[model samples]
Target: MTILLFGITKDIVGQPTLSLSHSEAQGLHTAGELKEFLKDNYPDMKKLSSLAVAVNSEYAQDEHAIKEEDEIAIIPPVSGG
Candidate 1:
């Protein structure tokens, strides 16, 4: 699975996108699982005050299912004057 990163999330990951092997994402069936996986693997991700998971361009909840073909992105809190 591919995860797009934006704003602070991108900075934390040091890239615009991240790819996870099938085995890595195999156990992550829900958004909550994905969050835990990310937090465990990428400690910096836990620093975000708020992180929104978007699947297919829509904000997803913890119960949202994650599919291999779905487009996923991490949106960190943003502020602008």
Candidate 2:
């Protein structure tokens, strides 16, 4: 899948994205599992809240079903000070 990953996600994954493996490809193997995947891989993000996500340009939830051919992205929490 092509994930339009952004924010710290890039740092965690070490890249924007390419092809992910099934071992960590949450929804790719079964149902929606973005939250689980993040918590497992990106433990630091566990504290992040009120974050929004978009799948293929549409707002989505952690449990939102993911397709192998879908494009996903995490809408980071914007900060300005």
Clashing pairs in 2: none
TM-score of each: 0.92, 0.71
The most accurate candidate by TM-score is 1
How does model 2 fare in lDDT?
Answer: 0.66
Clashing pairs in 1: none
Q: For model 1, what is the alpha-carbon lDDT of residue 80?
A: 78
Candidate 1 lDDT over 32-76, as tens digits, reads 788888888889887776789999999999899999888999988
lDDT per residue, candidate 2, 1-81, as tens digits? Answer: 566667776666677764666555644532236655665777876777665768878888666777776777766675767
How accurate locally, in lDDT, is each candidate? 0.88, 0.66
Off by over 4 Å in 2: 26-32
Off by over 4 Å in 1: none
